[model samples]
Target: MITSQTLRQESEQPRKCFVVGPIGDPHAAHGSPEREAYEHHLGIFEQVIAPACEKYGITAVRADGIAHAGDINEQICRHVVESHLVVADVSSGNPNVMYELGLRHITGKPTIHIGEAGQLPFDIASIRTIRYQRTRSHLAGARKEIESALEVGLRDGFELLTPARVLRGLQSGDGPASVSEIGDGANREDEDSPGLLDDFAVIEDGLDDMTADMEAITKTIETIGSLTEQSGAEMLDLSEANVPMNARLAAVARYAETISAPAGELNTVAAAFAERMVTMDSGVRAALGLIEMTPPDERGEGTEEFLEQLMSLDEAAQESLAQICSFGTSAGEMARMSRYLRKPVKEISAAVQQLTSAITRMGEWAAKARALAHSSAT
Candidate 1:
């Protein structure tokens, strides 16, 4: 069999993903059967599912990580919105899992449902569930079954996944699949308009370039800072020497100050980029519907208008992330300078802190932006 590392490498080659079952049961704390069911399900994820993902080059992020707070639901919504496929385990008819699965079905992404043998819920008995005996001996068989199911599900493409039944399952108050139908109509209208997708791609590329630039600039700044600090320390020692050494010290101070001026400017640039990055983060979230807009019930509500707004937000976010990347590069340069400069111990320490903080923020912002953009695209 292929190793987990090999599977991870292959999975990394493709960006598609799926959200599986819940991680924990709330009722487990109360000693309820629901809790046991949750545990049984989690075992499937940890022992069987996670390993299988490693083998197939698929990334499986569970809903449990995001569900501890009320934010679990939001996380589920986000994953469904972004993932290319979803595999839902509905063995015991868990309400939360079913609800999320329903959302996946509506979005029209490829979905595969699996459940333990003899435990299939009545409502979904018509849908096939891969059967597995809950025993150590059955694990290998279960793994093979899941992997095959995933490959087939992915091959079917996203269109087959968005059935009317699935959409109906997710609609509020048992409403019909009118929302999806409307969405379909809007998609048809935009079918010939390639500009939307193109514009989004452009923004994404711009952001990537900006991030690379920022990283480079920040590295340069850090190098210069280190050099300046070192020179300062050397000058201090020269100050204690004879006249010739003192003269050398004066020259060193002048050189250090001159080099530091550019570093200071670069620091400013980095800060400006940080501001832009935050803006991009907000924009991406807005575009992805993580942030609320006017209610759907508002006057003049239409799907096209909503989509237009979402696209606009995505564009803006992309721009902001790009700017952030630019700033991060400059900051990195300053950090390197700090490492080289050998200045007063206090000042060097402060600069080090600044560099560290800036780099950390840039990394975090980049991750969030990427996640947002990716989710939307899928």
Candidate 2:
């Protein structure tokens, strides 16, 4: 399993553009659950997206090809949030793909959407999907269109209002801001100097660092899972056996020690994640602040859509970190009790129960956060 740490860049790297869409291969027939669709998508990616990226010196990749062995959700979050560009195929409105596309939409970045003419959902049907027919003869044209879209998107797409922004404006009674209303100017002193969307490189780097921290924390969670699973049988047997209470207490303490090392490691990862969350959230707020400089006619309703999502993500991350600390604290306390207690009468039961409850609740919290983090649509 390769963690993000292994993939971290020590120096500047080419901007990345992630390909989002269904990669499933169905077998049997058209519209059948067994129909294979990945090959079709891959061809488009290889022919269209890859060439487009190369022209701009950007690297094109997809979620499946990522070499990391951490939480799949974490990996996707980094890509959707940090990628300089995204080319999504709404060929079927596949729920997961749409969810990712929805997340990308909230970013208000350069996103080029393409779909088969007949497969687009009603909500997005009029959004100018680059229509493509699936045929060998038409493949070239489709690829060219995609390349053209990339060129156009990279040059001016960032200034466009995302669907989220449009919807948000209506919901908040801010009235819609047309694409032309927003000016092309950005902070001049930025590293993307003279390029407004260029600071995304900084955002990308920050998210990548956060990804590394998340991957590390997830690995420790896996370790804890293993330890807990392996010890479950022993715990049950000890509960059933008629051993001395002190012996049983010592046994539980020993069991607690088994997870102490991994728990401590997780604690460190949690702290790192918390710190990164604060930094990342601050950067996002700053980006919003910069965008807010445009006059009311140009500024699209305060960028609250993006701000709200980032804030939700930030709050969840902090909660996850706290849950991790709870687990670590329980483990530490158990280990200490084992070291200091000569004989356990009542304290042992309390410590054991506390550790068990903490581990269970931590798992629950992690699962919920992972689900939310993975879905931009939510």
Candidate 2: clashing residue pairs, number: 6
lDDT of 1 by residue, 136-173 (tens): 76866887877776554334322343233332233333
Highest TM-score against the true fold, candidate: 2
Instruction: Per model, state how many residue pairs clash.
Output: 41, 6
Q: What is the Cα root-mean-square deviation between model 2 and the actual structure?
A: 17.2
Q: What lDDT score is found at residue 57 in candidate 2?
A: 61
Could you estimate the TM-score for every candidate? 0.41, 0.43
lDDT by residue for model 2 over 304-328, one digit each (tens)? 3333434444444455455445554
Stretches of candidate 1 off by over 4 Å are 1-16, 26-35, 67-70, 153-159, 162-189, 192-378
Q: Model 2 TM-score?
A: 0.43
Local distance difference test, candidate 1: 0.51
Off by over 4 Å in 2: 1-11, 25-35, 167-378
